[model samples]
Target: MNPLAKLDQLDLEPAAKTEVAALIQSLIEQAERDAKIIQAKDAVINAKDVKIAALTHELAYYKRIRFSTKSEALAPLQRDVFEETWNTDISAIEAEVEQLQDDQPCATVARPKRLRAGRQPLPPHLPRIEHRHEPEFCTCGQCGKDLVKIGEDISEQLDVEPAKFFVHRHIRPQYACRACETITAAPIPPAVIDGGMAAVGLLTWMLIGKFLDHLPLYRLEQIAARDGVSLSRSTLADWVGRLGVALQPLAERLAWHLRQRSSLHADETPVPQLDPGNGKTKKAYLWAYRSNDLQPGPKIIIFDYQAGRSGRHAQQFLQDWQGHLVVDDYGGYKALFAATRAHPETQYILESCIELACWAHARRKFFDLFQTSQSPVAQEALNRIAELYTNEAEGRDMTADARQRLRIEKSLPVLTNLHDWLQQTRLTAAPNSATAKAIDYSLKRWAALMRYAETGDLPIDNNPVENSIRPIALGKKNWLFAGSERAGQRAAVIQTLLGTAKLNGLDPAAWLKDTLEKLPAWPNNRIDELLPFAAPD
Candidate 1:
């Protein structure tokens, strides 16, 4: 029954009852409003609690990183790839914590600044070019008398020559052989592209700027213009197209060498290709295959740009080549493994390819879970994975046999424990939970994950090729998309050569310039001599 209805039963006058009912209604409405406000406050508090937990976990991670041994930290390559994001994450977390605590007054504690290496002297080997600066007047301003020079204080500033342009004037004097009336001086020197205005050096600069430096041709044009040189975009495009054709042989040779390795790393990154018909872009793939670092040979990386990410692209690239291939759990590579071989009745006997799963991929799932939810299960998984990496680091520089022995002795035990833990954890974890998914991922690929421990030549992860793809991923921001499929393939050719050059520790620009100079006249029979891996004469 309504409380207001109870007034009817009370012994009171009509007006008195009406007044009492109004007061009761007002109080009830006020109580309802108060309940809603409290509910909202509770919701806000819940959100803050979740946010605080994530931030606290992040802070603890940073603290561990600060005090942890070098072997326990991320590898150098991974550090280089993630350093910027880590810094940004730290700042974002601090801001969020400050916002959450703004309403509450608390004692503030100052954090110690992280110790960092101070700026050291500039490289001593770089040639120093001197520039003298003199005052407008040699006389003192106050005293109208000439000032005597005592000494000069000099400080060095790091400087760069941004696309400095110069001209090479080739003057062929006409011979005064009136009898023959033949103006025969030295025949024009052999050129990479005869009659082209760009010298091999200039061509090299443009190639390096475009591919290695990740600058687009238009940007290269703007850079050249800054140096009072006018290089049209079309001309650059023309040069690039011709260079791709010229360097295709070298890229092919590098790919051949890459296949010779018994172990390899394969990975891919998506690239945007312009779709002229739709007035938009379509997805393309740049498949990167890198030779094993443990193998005794030059480091080779080949990029094969294709229209799509179908498994055929990889199959075609690795046709007749067989080795241990390290890759992520992408479905496209499923056909490459013998157990999952899509074509079992092929006429020719295909070489066997052993599939190796990347531990980093498996660990990344738990890493992300820990980051977002601070799950203790995920944290434990990460700790176990870290132990495996620590062992790998200890034997990083050892010979293949030694590394294999070290892994069997030190890493196999950890792997055994991790596998057992994963299996046990998965049984108890909820089927739909993130922890279960992470555990299942490792369990499904347990054999491949542990295979690296069985061989020293196999990498623990597909980081080598992934690291090579990083530059291309970064380049996509500037270049945007390839104009056509052909353009993308051409880009792959150039990137393969330049990337291979970088892997060999050669200055890409210098190697490219020398190669361009020799390529036009170099014999095809001896073409391998001009590859990026070859030592300069």
Candidate 2:
């Protein structure tokens, strides 16, 4: 009790003020300690990043050095193939060396053919005509006389026509009994028995004759008469109109199904759409979408037509589609990529043509420069590019993933080094300089350009689609454009069936004939099955 009273008495007004100051000083010290802790945390993050970079560098170094050669450049700096033969007269020394070493005899070298740089030869020969009739007596007064042949004249021309086919319709009749109203006479099982028009076989021929073969209706009518089928251009057009209506549902479904696939290739070409308002015409666009069953999934291809080339056209086709969609570097697809919003974010179709970037295209650019003094870079790139192709040609049939893995393991380093070398050279070259220009091109689209090494399954080029569109391009040359939007739509449907039939290894005319005659009676639930592509042989 005495100690507690003494302690309470010591806490007077002056003592209380001293004690409060000490408490405030301790709180300030704790704040300083927390600041040091935060600084240490940042330092740790910085140290970790440094280590990561160092390890990455070390790994790359080991991988390159582990290879057989010190430098994994695409190829050696020197060119291998001889530009010209300079055979030394060392045959005696070669035989002695071969005898001593038990080696094979030295082979003789022959010089390569030299191109004669000159104007190409003129036409083979002049026309050989004697012109037998000479001049007779001339008229003096009002008397009849003969005249001499005038001086010979020569005119030369080369003519070309667009690729063109014919439609044949065989119309068969049917009779029904009104007494029973049940029994009816019909055409042959596969003949054109519906709607009392062209026979089944004729319509089929017409479908292929015009669509697959790219023949105009007028030409088809002419051919049909020769073939003993009396089909008129107008009647063919009318039947085509009906055919379009009948197949619209299938065509629409085909387009939808093609878009649903995960990975697809796309291309577009200018289409001339006829003008109804004025007699004038405007250039529209027909877009193509193709899918293959070989690598990624089941194959499907479709062509889409539109009034204009707006980005909206692309958006409309790809609106709900998601996943890999291969396309050229067109700005129209930007909105499409943004909208798909796929989870796990696989590469966009923009990356699909990666496998087609090969030595062929790259090498073609430098062909003229190969033997010139400005050839080291071009030749090096070519040789290294050749290595990648050599690998591809050897392993092209392998799966895309396997092929990609091999590239990453083997060819990837060479590509990387080649790309790096090109990049460095590009900076020192002139803007208009030829070598500089070549290097710049290789550097710019280099990555997108060389995607071919990724897999063998992809096309070497966009040639298939190009080949398919060639018919339409030819048609454009002759017919110029569709007579109406309805005609354009009809072209799309007939082309779809004919093209699909061709793709599926069937005779288009036969398939078309069978499909048209039987499609009306085909079950609604099995509509998709009746499609040319999906139909059984």
Candidate 3:
């Protein structure tokens, strides 16, 4: 039945038959080559399409950076029908209040309005210098009568004293024994930096200025020069370096304390490090670990600096640390979780660390697509994720058991529906498109994302640690880069203490001043007493 076989069976001379067969074979070969060419062309077209999509996405991203607000929150008008509904509700409330006042037998009392919308009164703890004012005459000129003082009105305006520099002279008075001719003198107190001129107070001030205030050593040096203190940048750097070595023990203790918690949030941010050999800057990472926001204990945040963003960095920092680690879907953490699963018997770096994926990260992907593409699918995903956030908001202050029940009652259904929708949506979306990638990211981490609902101790997202990273991100813009790897590590040490102080609602300057003063003689075992939260109230 083959067309070639029919040609073979045709009656003709032997040479004519052979010629016909050769022509037919040549045509078939040409047809096969043409088909291959068409297939190759199709592949090229597909590759070009992918390239175009990527370029378009990149262009959109740059446009957003130029024109859009960085916040993911919707504008007021887009969020709700603010003009129509909010105004109507306010007017109705005012009318109702007026009607109620009209029906009252007594005169209506007007509510006191705020003088202006700005700063509240300064804290009472701040020292005040009172200035008294009195009239020139005690008696009124018009009445010619004696005036009695009733009450004094006190108005306060904040005042600042510029930086003052002074030298502390450690004068040692010697006494000679009358009979034995032996001399004795009082011993000087120990200093934070031995043989160094800087006092604990000065060191503390410099640290708070640089780390908390995000001022670099060079800038601090300039500020000091203006204040008549000619401290060089190298001198300031030396102090910071020594301080880092001295306070390293405290940072380690904080990390130990964090690991002991049942659950904690983990995150990392990029830091630029100076590569002396290359004469260029290289990227490093600051790994952040903090106790759960809902947990009842002294809140602690520790930053561990690493030269690379490798899984080994986190593993080493969290050595044998067993707890729930709430983090984003960074592949570096996967190895740690895998170790725990593969060898439950052996104590690995993160033997019992539970991986809880962040919903915020997953939602961020969809949000980016929605912002760029204005896709309905992305918007739907956002709406669903928002519901989970609402549930978390309601249960934020609740106990673990109560929050777990609340999540089950409210968030679980939404999560289930979201998962199903993402699975179906993935099939319809183009394989290489952004929408598909977003869907794939969420679906792949579905279990980890839902793990939060299992316990109230875990947060729905790793926002707390992410929030802690913001300071470093902002500081990077000012300080630019660390002088070396060691310098970066030093920054991490100070950042840990300052970050922990902020979390505990303590002033960084005050905490550092007190800690630095006592840390010199503070016993190793009682170091916890010197922590920011444990410091004198």
Candidate 4:
């Protein structure tokens, strides 16, 4: 009854019948192969559609986050941290979408073009070194006779010098004794790097360029090469090492001062370290600790580089210091809050570390949920939290005692109501739902969250330290990763000094240059005088 089977019944000679059946079978096989090919093509098309849909969704999400007014949910400094990443991701997604569209057989919709601002005048404050371009011939092209010049068209372009390398020749004349024929020259002045060719100014430039500006040593070398200066990466690396050694005491002193404060902010970010054995990179941590901005003292930021995010690393850095520590909900810092725990170094029992939970972090949980689902519960929670922040914002410039009074008058009731609301909300929410998890986070840390309301001397959140760490996070993307543990630690040292300088409203380059010049001849006992901040008011 099959179509192919009918070939066998056809009336013909024996050889003709055999040839007809064989041809029909071959045709059936070819048809089956064609059907299989069509199915595979459909599957491929479906997969591509799914991929494009996902990419489109991601692109839209990033665009909304980047362009929407709600992007200001985080503090300016916090938002600044991820601005570059969002821009890069958006560009990458757009490029991938374009590529995929080109591959498709069907017509594709192009992305909407972003409106761009017209070119603006360059800053008038910049010292312009002008280069005038004049025509080779004063006469018009069509005319043989010379022509007088009229008003010239003028335009300005912003230009920069990467590094203007210069020489500082320190000439020391030799003096000879007439009788003994003894010759002597002035002794070389002390330098951060002894007997080094680099001046303090040059050292400062390299240091700031590599650490603060996030330029790698090789990049610095390349920059110098463009100026016809021969600076090998090896030499740059050696200078960084020596500079770290010279600046270590200052960073350590900063840590000492930071611990002396009654309260502080702490956080950590991951850094990559090269592993030669596996020929890949491994994770490291840069733990950042900062003095509370509200307290009456000089601002300080200390960076501690560790191979892992063990609680022990924090314990080691904190030592016997005890104070209110404003931090995120990282489990690593939980050990620090235990009533009794062995010291990281001495193994001696110590008092518990008072915890002050970060409101910004708690707010982020609800913020993320609201963004994703537009849940009324998240909105209500955000409103309550925003009320608390509003009170804090009003009292930001107030004295410690005045701020505390303001919080007691304003923030305490809101916090109490918010806690009650969260408890009630949790009862109705599914135990495994994201809403429940978010509620639990706040409820579990309620006491720590309320601590800041009781004392204005303590910070409301850990944004200060996180803000300080943001530069380091941004820097890693540029330099990629540390070549070794020593390199990471050295970076931490320089970052501490430079970051503190910036926090205290000092120009980092100028401060670093001055510090380098004084460090060599500076006495150990008087090192505090060389801190980024002048003596605390």
> Which clashing pairs does model 1 show?
none
- Which model scores highest in TM-score? 3
Cα lDDT computed for each candidate against the true fold: 0.85, 0.61, 0.82, 0.87
RMSD (Å) per prediction: 15.1, 36.3, 27.9, 12.7
Superposed Cα deviation of residue 71, candidate 2 (Å): 32
Best lDDT among the predictions, by candidate number = 4
List the candidate numbers ranked by lDDT, top first. 4, 1, 3, 2
**lDDT comparison, 1 vs 2, better candidate:** 1
Could you tell me which 10 consecutive residues in candidate 1 have the lowest summed lDDT?
104-113
**Residue ranges of candidate 2 with Cα displaced over 4 Å:** 1-194, 227-229, 276-278, 293-298, 338-383, 432-461, 534-537
Shift in Å, residue 516, candidate 4: 1.0
Report model 1's TM-score to 2 decimal places: 0.74
Residues 1-537, candidate 4, lDDT per residue (tens digit)?
676577667778889888877888899899999999989877777777777778889999998988884644666655776787898999898888777767866523444464568989888878988788888987889977887877888888777865678898999999999999999999888988888999998999999888898888888888888888999988888888998998999999999999999888889999999999999999999999999899888999999999999989999999877889988999999988985877899999876699999998898889888988999999999999999989988998899999999999999999999999999999999978989988988998999999999887888888888878888877888998888999899899999999999999998998998888888999899988999995555
- Candidate 3: C-alpha RMSD to true structure equals 27.9
Look at candidate 3 and tell me the lDDT of residue 319: 84
